[model samples]
Target: MKKILVVFLVIFAGAVQAQEVLQAGFKLLENGQFAEGAAFFKHYLTTQDATNKTALLCYGRGTGLSGNVTEAKEVFGKLLQRYPGDFEISLNAAEALMWCKEYAEAKRYYEKLLTEKPNDFAANLGYANALASLFEYEKALVFTEKALQIQPSNDNAKLSRKYARLGLADYFVKNQDYHRAAPLLESILSENATDKEALFAKAQLYIQLERYNEAEKIYQQLLQLTHGQTEVYLNLSYLSFLQANKPLAFEYANKAVESTATQPQKYLTARLGRITALGWNGKFKQAFAELDSLDSVFPNNNDLLIKRAGLSIWNKEFAHSVSLFKKSLRNVPSSFDGNLGVADALFAQELDDESKKYVLKTLEYYPNQKDAKDFLAKLALRHAPALTTHNFISSDKGGNASKNYQANVAFDVATALRFNVGYRRREVSNSLENNSANVQTMTAGLRWRVKPFWLITGAINVTKLEKDGAVAPFKTFDIASEFRLNKFQTLELRHNSDVQSFTAGLVGNQLSFKNYIATYNLSTPFKVGVYSQYYYTKNSDGNTRNLLFASLYYDLKATPVVKFGINYQRMTFEKRMSRVYFSPFLFRSYEVFGVSENLNVPKQKFLYQVSVAGGMQRIEDEAYQATYRASLTLGYKPSANIELTAYSLYSNSATSSVVGYSYSETGIKAKWILLKKQQY
Candidate 1:
């Protein structure tokens, strides 16, 4: 009887100790101290059965939520293995694997759990997350919906659904179905305005659409949230560069570089931004120097190699660009940018046949590549009889700030014969009068390649300028003979009976000048060219004028991507041209110096040009005015065949022609290829 009493006492003590440990763990978890609770649960489990359901549940939940995912996965995995029939253990293990990105195994456990409790919200959310990670969006969404129905206020269920939608959106983005991706992202943002991933995605889409204002707003929001995200700053810098705000571009790029010290990937991307900003700012040597250092640091970085190739292309170093692109391809053979770079570099060298395969390859990867498609359209016109059409807003000029929108269609009936038709609408605004005038010009033309290397093209434009109680009728005729000296050289002589253009923010046809122009362009194997033009004009009063322009251009080794030129003119005007606009070209003779550069931002589907010209303008008889002008133009191509360009020009003495006073002009031009002939 005494021995029995001692045994009962021992059993009671053991039971009390087990209760104490369990209560301690539970109490620790109640205070949300997961690490401490997990340790207590682990200690309690060591003194009990390995498959104790209550102990396993406490241990797994505590371990998983304590940020110990790997060890938690091991604990839950062992629990499931030992207690194969335990429903709770299986569910936690499945979620643990899902969090750990072991999707296949997670799905297996989830399947087992679902067969037992089909409508369990936790099971459904975990399964949906696993499926979404595995790219099974459709299945994921079904499970997510079920989870939400079971627990409408569950944050995890909502997040699971969001992830599933994002998975589909990602697929749509890859397929170039931005229309589909857009609403998905917008929906997510509407639900959670502070969602960083959704905001970043939205910002990127805005950038792609060339909506800089909207993109800037989004990026600024992101920046306010966290100053440490370097990519956001880098992208802002690129945006500033695109808008010709070089100072802001440099600032943001520098910020991007300084924002991170430990993240290698962000450092490399920020370095790319710095290089691009410097190049745009005309600091090519500095940009190239940075490139060399970046290359040494991130030697096998495909993006670095591709960026170098693109920079080379901008510099007009075609062969060097090709070499860099090849090196990039060696790292990523299927790289879309690498293939496109090779094609563009080859095209710049006038190697059409060799570039064809690369263009085709680019199309294979991204069929919507605008540059490649435009090049292909040009190629089709070159090699076979094809039809092509273009609508370009082209450029803007003057104090009145004239805008010309021209659309043209051409049909190559044969290799030697082509017919073309076009329409142009010109708008001019008078700021002082607060009035606007429009001119409608209808045009038709033809091209006849009389010789294999020689061609003649002629066009006639009938202009009807209707404004404030005045309807003026005018006819302009232009004809040109193009002599293709060799594959990459051309000499053209053009005559214009009356051609309309803008001068000093005013009407170019105010005097309807007759122009005789000769242009000669020569490209050498060294990949540079000389472009020279000489023109003589006689105004309506029959007084003649002479103008000469000469420039050395780099087609394929141009650093800073510029063409610098000098112009000299000797003109005695028979009469002063017009009323609303002003001109500094008042004297008989003038000399001007200028530089221009066009840049196509790599991978951005955007092109922009910046020009600065300064000269001595003869305003009064024997009187000279010091004049300077600047212009910025940005363009976007939505597809291979469609392009839109917006431009702003400012000149006191710049964009179209030097003037006596400050003039600002802004306009938009849209171009579309209505017809393309494919040799293939």
Candidate 2:
């Protein structure tokens, strides 16, 4: 019995010694001393052939830490194969694959581990990291939440959750989903209030939503917390610049430069911020000097090259801007910013084809770029007019032969407001009579954005008509508000009113009308809307009209721009008309098709749209009429501040037998865009 007891003790002591060696090896591997740890683990495994799960896991970890990723992966795989239900082996394999950057494979292993141990903190955290690496941020947040739930006190797990949340927030911000990102950033700041990164993100979100006061508050808080950290000061400076607070912007920008640590990134950001502030404050010379200084500091920085290009564009140095943009593209061959900058410079130089090439190149890399899309749309409108021509052939009563000539010009304007103005003019002649009727009008408005969810707008219309010894003038004033109900739904309220007096040929009419309308619009790739309107008239009688309208607009997004929009309106008269009236009086119905494109010019850009619309309206059986109206417009911008527009209108009513008259007009206009109290 004594001899058997001694043998048993010797065997047990040897096994314990092997286990201690394996633990020590794993500890070294964990601390990143991989080669020596791997050697120790190999020796221990050789002496003890039937090593337990812990020793096998340690061996795999050591192999991975020593840069033998293949061997580590195979070791973990064998362990998993032998102990199929072991979460530890599964987690080890997942972590090794993560270090190797095999994010998809790591995610598979982590998910399998979680299936076995639902609350396993390591597995959940590993899964989050894997998903994050793959840019599956929404899914990553789920795993991060599980990890937090399992180990609430684990700092690593908490930090991982925070990062995942931040990733989600950034995704929203990039997609222009400010309303969604704002709350997420707010939650992050509420939890870790001193997190400078989160605070900066929150401030940017506020700025995008146009909550300038809130953004300023958060920026000030960040500056206080960071004691004028370079990033905080730079952001504050940008905010000040946007709000037109030049002195404060300059002060903060200088502070940003002074506070930057001796790091390339810090110095670059500070210098760029100061330069931008100077440019926005109208100190172009100082801004250019700062750009030159930046060039001296970081001669090879592609980011600085891009910034200089942007400054050149702002200063109207188109040739220099193009050169800098092209140079930056050499350093960063796939840079979307560089491509876009080059495109803008080319556009400014009126090299439409060359500019379009760069714009398309940018779209190839960044398909969802809104600025690129808008620029392309504008370009399409610019070149459309020169490609098409029209002629008017007509003969009237009194044995008179009538002929007319018309021309159009189109263009675009850029500011906080983006506008497309078009104009067309006509000249009429006859053997018995000759008169030039000029019809001039303009349609200019912007999608006024106060926030992601709220918008307010004001637009105006002026019309002048010339004919036989009579002048007809019409003007409209409009105010509207739109609210986004969700990603796909919006509600709008609009008030549009027009006052006009007409005297031409035997028709002399004066009318004043006001329309109050509300619309519920839902949009996807296709747009659908239902609207109701109450119109008050102060012309022939003090009457009111209640109208219900529905419209569907579809876009094929194809070349040649195939768009189909149809609207149906039903009118109910509150007071009967003196003239015969038709029931369910179809207020407006039309189908339009056209091709449009933009043309780049030396001083400005042009937008040309040509469409043919035909429809019919009914008042009664005898009063019914078939209507065909051809409208053409040309808008020209010789410079940012100068615009010339011409417009023409020709219509004929079969029932009225009054071959609808043709009128055209042209006007030269100038704008002071940045003037104080100009109400652009």
Candidate 3:
């Protein structure tokens, strides 16, 4: 066979070239000129015996150096078959594969070579890198450790060990095992302060732990070292947002959004941070628009949907908020934000029965959540929470004789109802002697949620008045219907047969009036609110009056401490609206203009408010007096859910009387709210 003979001749020629290379002792290839070395080895292979071990070894090394690892492996395999146990040739083959970054193939040869030269430093280090590349850090560390023990002061061994630790740390981090990953990352940074990998890991670790100040410090260092880190910018922006620095948060978020990183997750984080900054700045419309855009980019992301739900809740769109929360729960059923948002939105909508279910669900996942606990407590009292009221009024005209005092307490009579009982004593007297009548009254009241959206309430009072040994007995009725449109909106219509009996400070020898009042309130947290009332009264002395009142408050989002508001009132008389025969009092017509200020100083558990009003009082048919009134309210919250408040009002003149006089009234309100634990 001619082909067999040609192979024999090639083998013979390779052996001759090997003899020549031995005489030359690799003069051309030994100088580290890899191109020339490859050419010289190829020239030797052209006519030499392919089975020549020396020439074959040189050829594999040359081909591997020339970046043809597969060909190099083939050349080495030929010689390895003939001399499979030769150290020099086998190591060359493994090293060639490693050079080409074929780590898995190189690991195989290294395994075989280790049996021959078990203590070889190069083999151990190479094997460690191979295992690390395969993400087998646990196994890789074993090899790295052995390499270090064999060569204690070797830089290559130390580098391999460090790499193994970094690889293992990355592994732990991916598994969310930050506690195990932290020490390894710190060890790397301790040796090299500028280790970017370790620094980034450490910074993220701090972020997860909520050690934000420390994270900020490391991120600053990272910025100086690496200018193109999108996540760092986004994280810093989030930190700014948490600190309530809206402008700074927006600035950093813009930087992250402008980054050129190709990672979609990086862009997602940046955009999320930007959205948060927008929300913090009170840019709800803009934030919602941007959220719509984010929805297109991340259609199924639970975090974005939860964020949208939170914004909806802030906007007082409870129905929409619940919808978004439900969608988010569809994807991540146990998400803390999603579940809690559902509970809160339901509570806001006055759907406490449904809210209770979700609140318990939230507590199942997050047992120590304050919001859930607080909501549970409120849910327990939703149908009929307890209520208490106390009133003490003493006139400046006389002293304790012209005084009225009342106290009442109410609690749940049933799931959908409540009941209250109280008694009031009124003494009318002048500056000298007991010259006026005294009246005593006992009152009872009840409220019932007759339907999902309807509430009915009624009150009854029995009164007995004595003047000059003559006694008059009378009974009064008060009833109302309430419409609970949503958590933020309500409407009520009430009618009272004796308005003076219900008015805390009015202790006069005057005819009583039957009053009808319609009140509307739309209020929510961290928002502007409006309250309006239309009141009509008809007195026993054939007098009728009508009053329209409007009050509004705009609470600033950025500074929740301050609220700006105003109140406007107009009163119109149709007849002799007041009939205090013995006193110089007659209600004709009046109007009021008032400004209100509410303040809760930053970083304090105290709240305060002041309101001042000026009005024109029509005391006589053609006479009027300038009436001034002011009020102060102070509140101190000593602990969670407990509050103490004091309120005082001063009037420059009594606007409803023919005689102008000033009076002061003060009251205190204390509340102890307790959040209860609920079972899932």
Candidate 4:
């Protein structure tokens, strides 16, 4: 019985081998004669057991190649289950599954082979392709890179990488990230300059960005490289139509249809371009004829339908445009262009509700549509009244004199100019001083946004002062430019030279001081900065003194809203009159530190910032002062045009005692933002 069993087993093995040869031949036949070969392979699979792995693989391939997807999937699955560890069989099964469009199963098998041997180039490439087909581009890129690394010379892997890159570019483009897509497309073109697809993508991007010159260059390059390919010709013709070059546009349109490319869509594009150019060039009848020809060729094409609707709308044929829009919507019910065209036609026909319905529908389909957004904004603004508000206050006080206040209403005429006129009052409290004054001042200024980093300002202040003894009148002219280096740095240069004559208690004292200072400052939290100023001052004694000053500061933010800063300053005078004093009249050194917290309020307003500062100053060894100062400022915004500010400053100095003089004053102030503008 053992001998008989051995002979039977050998006979079965021979039969299996013979069947495998027959199956391989059948697969070859399927490659050459698909119909008859598929019949033979199917008949053999039914009659003979396909336990032979190679035979089963051959049967799977034959069925897959012959378009018998369901049968091919079944056979591949059986082969995988029976020969789980066979890499060749698994790869073939995966390929068969891919042909069947069973991507998930194909990916599973490919991943299995890859897991066993990651450097399996064929498995890696196949897996990546499967992932790309499923639109999993980012994951596909990883495997595609692996495949290229394993076999750098593989053209298939290189092409797969190109597709992956193009996929990523398209993804970014769909998300409106044009900046990201631009570099990827450029890299692809660098690798293959004549890549017509990448060139076309670049042209489309340029068109969307309104970069007509760049778009024209790319379209011309594509036309030359592709030898007047129909798509390229159509692109060029459309661009010419946009530029109103009728003759050139019609020539390119003719060339597009004359090309050997067989795509019907290319012919339709050519027809549309030619018709649009003819209509724009005043050959209306000819343009209509071209549309009729397109209708004859593709009666159901929705794009052509929409194009006809647009032409009707442009020609003021409201009824015709409406009919075309409705017909197009039968095929594409949610078409963005069709809905927008219907809305426009209804609006032109005075169908308000219908127009709004279609417009809202268009926006529902394409929420980011620019035309729809603009239309909605304009409609909203039509029913709302624009509001304007303005308020301002100004106050000043001099030592040993009465206080003055000015109230004004400001109006903004333009970004660069503002007009303000208000009432002013001045009074003294003590009867012995017997002082009263009143004057009205009109102030105006011009503020220009010279650039994103600079502002130019010029203002004039005319004032009238009255005292018990005499009357004093003065005018001041100031011009300044503020420079912004970055978020945290600023420099201001100003020229201010004014003359003022004072009266006694009622008229104030005759004291005059004139100076022009140019200052440079740099400010940043956690950064070291420097400030310098040079000024020339003339006192009532007719002595002119030149002052040079420099300060170094560093700021630290201990919390989000609290900032602390320390500064050191050195000042020098240029000349001294006393022969006993050979050195400069003023030599001062100072060091100070302070902390401030910023308060933010709603409606475009802010509040200050109470801070305490302490420092020391020395003047040429003649007098030294240790100082302590505290300040409180309140900022109020009555309107967008005005800010009212009031602050109190208190300081105690040791030098005041040594010099037989002490100075302390508190003041309130308000400023109006006459003009505010920004430029880039």
RMSD of each: 13.0, 21.7, 12.0, 22.6
What's the lDDT for candidate 1?
0.70
Indicate the worst ten consecutive residues by lDDT in candidate 2. Answer: 1-10
What is the per-residue lDDT of model 3 for residues 1-680, given as tens digits with 9 covering 90 to 100? 00000000012345556486543425544454555666776776677655556667766766666667788788877777888677767667676666667778878988987887789776776777777777777898798888888888877666767777887876676555779989988888888998887788788777766677898899899888877688778778887765657799899988888884655557877887788777777678899999989888778888898888888887778888999999989988888889888988877766666777887898788665655776665566454334444454545442323466666666666656778787878766655444666789889999787775788999999988776777768789999999978767899999998734322224344457798999999886557789899988777767677777787876654343444566665666665423342122244434344444434433347877776766675544647767777788888877544557778777756542222346666767665433344421
Clashes of 2: 25
RMSD of 4: 22.6
lDDT of 1 at 514: 86
The local distance difference test score of model 3 is: 0.69
lDDT, residue 350, model 3: 60
**Model 2: per-residue Cα lDDT over 145-212, one tens digit each:** 88878877877766766777788888887677777887777777788888887888888888877688
Question: Which candidate gets the maximum TM-score versus the true structure?
Answer: 3
Local accuracy by lDDT, each model? 0.70, 0.63, 0.69, 0.63
Q: Per-prediction count of colliding residue pairs?
A: 11, 25, 7, 5
lDDT of 1 by residue, 1-680 (tens): 00000000001235446666477776676677888988887887787756656666777778877778788788877876778777766777777776576788888878878888998776777777777877888788899899889988867577767777777776776555789889988888899998888888888777667788998999899998775589889888988876668889999999999887856567777888888888666576788888888778777778888988888877666778899998888888889889988988877765666778999998887766655776687666454432333333322332245566666776666545778888887776655546666778888899886764677999998987766656678899999999977655799999988634443223433546788999998876454667788878776644555566666655432433555555554434444443423332444333444444444433346777777767776654656767677788788777545667777766664323423346666667665555435543
- Summing lDDT over every window of 10 consecutive residues in candidate 4, give the lowest-scoring window: 1-10
TM-score of each: 0.56, 0.51, 0.60, 0.47
Model 4 residue runs over 4 Å out of place are: 1-52, 65-67, 84-97, 100-117, 260-266, 279-282, 293-303, 334-340, 343-680
Descending-TM-score candidate ranking = 3, 1, 2, 4
